[model samples]
Target: MRSKAAVRARCLSYTGCVGILVLSCFLISSCGNRRIVDHIKLIQSAGYDLDGKRVRSTILIGDYTEKEKTNIKILSTESVSSMDTMQRQNTKSNQSLHTGQMRLVLFGKQFAKQGIGSVLDRLFHDQFISSRLRLAVSGTNAAGLLSSTVNTHDTLFIMNMVEQNEEWGNLPKLNLQTSLYNYYGAGRDLFLPYLILEGGTVKIDGIALFKDDKFATNVDIRDAFVLKLLTENSRNGSILMPLKESDALPDDYILMRSIASKRTIQLVSQEPAPVILIKIKMKVSVREKPEYIRFETKEDISALERKLAAYLVKKAEDFISLCKSKQVDPIGLGDFMRSKSRGWNEKDFQASYPSLKAKIRIDLKIVQSSLSQ
Candidate 1:
């Protein structure tokens, strides 16, 4: 019963409603796209340093399209805190500085030696910074660590090397997230593996140990290898063990495809010069039998085990000696003491740790022999 004019009017109103609805949806989606800022260069590596009153942050910008290319941009601002510096950076940068993809956070040797607790507290509090990002101590300035280049087999090269090492477990991977956990956790000392660029390759020179907030000392590769075996459960790796005169090897021996490890700690006396008992268990497979020894008996295996036990005991003692000399509780001896004996003050606990006597016992059991004559 509707007339042509009325029907036309109704049709027009329906069409208008449909158009309005479509426009609303388009507006919402367009707003989403508007918020997304492109051309923001991704930062792969970052270095931080303290300059008088403010902190200087250096970021490495990489061209994703051309994997071979990289550029270093320095962002400096005088602010009361790290967050303030970041806010200032946002105003100057054309592209938003996103830290979701950050891989390496390098601390200058000077800053590390002094103390990193304050700086690290700020880093861990950031919402954008990943907890799992790799952390390293630079032998030189942090800026040098970010800017230095290493040429290697791959096209992407150095960046690829870092990624591969982290993924394959060939090297110790310590990140900001793991560092914070170890730092705050009681009875656990934190350690970061140091990286130094040398002869076109990045080498894991040693480990940097921390006592409270300061750098304790640099443990060499030999000590680090043993530490790795002791702390971690996985033991599939290679190491070079010194050959003794009575052993079968010529001058020195190299162990390949071997796994070594052991860990045991005990609380001895409570008063009158408190003592702690530490036990270590290790097992190594013979990869290459040295020319100095002729073997084919059970006695050989037992003798090798004994030799390995003695070697481990000596190494453990050496490490303990080094720790004692530094007056650094890198082994979490303080934590063990606190756990065993409650109602202990931090100040008094630290004071007592210097003279704490540690008795270490090492036991080596030969599990398998890979050498075939």
Candidate 2:
């Protein structure tokens, strides 16, 4: 029989050996899967355009020679499907193309109108693709925008532009994950940021409304600001309001900047048809107002707030009317109704959507002022 100390020593040796074996296997597996950043082409951005019956896909990849410097490579190919287009592009690339680091994907107006359901589905199913990828619709052609010589120095130019607008400008917050949720989930249609190239420069033009993955129409950035107000809380979003004559302002225009906002949707009366009353309470600051109008008194401020409220209500109603006319539900009113009502039928709602009554009420409060003297 072995002594107790000797047996314990043998057991400890065995455990150490097993641990070393497992660590060695892990290291080997990790090495096998290791990808050299310099050798692989990481796609930074991609775009899809409709080219007659086929699809024209453009991919932007950045080649880094050192830590800070990068060279952008643009490639274009045409195929029946986006997947096939990518496969064809890979053949032309010197190194293996990877999408793990992809930041944005753009769809041309024509391509988006044709329907991006299948293409979006393919992206959602990809294991390496990020859910937070930014997706947008080009006001013109996506291929043209991607292949443009403008902003070639920075591969993330378009992405950063869109991001900044969403953060401080009038654009809404959106990403692939949120888009996919709205697209796949019931009661709401998908909407994307719309980009247009003006004077060889890319700019956020508006918001594109979608009807079942097909582009329906677009609203200008001002209207997009209104849409953002209805859907979510907005901060630092500015809009130029046309002041009414009754407001007693010398100038017809005043720029109101949203400091914060909160909205409530009430489903009023579900019989026959559903009526929605959307109430928005926004805290705002005057970015630019008529020099004659002094906000020193509470009554003066109250009058200005009332004027802003009336303008906002009119704008919101007009926008809702536009959505109803186009048969698009970017506001997700149906979803809100569905949450309130039991046994909601999408078909029934859609049928009555055009005639569905909605009322907008805005309560604007002036929290600060930075008027031009």
- What TM-score does structure 1 among the candidates reach? 0.76
RMSD to the hidden true structure, all candidates: 6.6, 2.9
Q: TM-score each candidate.
A: 0.76, 0.92
Please give the distance, in angstroms, between residue 322's alpha carbon in candidate 1 and its true position after superposition: 1.2
Separately for all candidates shown, the number of backbone clashes (residues 3 or more apart, or on different chains) is 3, 0
Model 2 Cα lDDT, one tens digit per residue, 1-373: 9999999999999999999999999888887556789788999899999989889999898867767877788988889877688789999999988999898999999999999998889889998999889999999999778766335667777888888999999888898898998898888999999999888878889999999999999999999999999989777789998766467444778888999999899988887878899999999988877766787788998999998899889899999999999989998998988899899989988999988889999988998655333
Per-residue accuracy of model 1 over 4-25 as CA lDDT, tens digit each = 9999999999999999999999
Worst 10 residues of 2 by lDDT: 243-252
Off by over 4 Å in 2: 1-18, 21-33, 149-152, 244-251, 371-373
lDDT of model 2, residue 240? 90
In model 1, which residue pairs have backbone atoms overlapping below 3 Å?
Answer: 131-177, 248-292, 248-293
lDDT of each: 0.65, 0.88
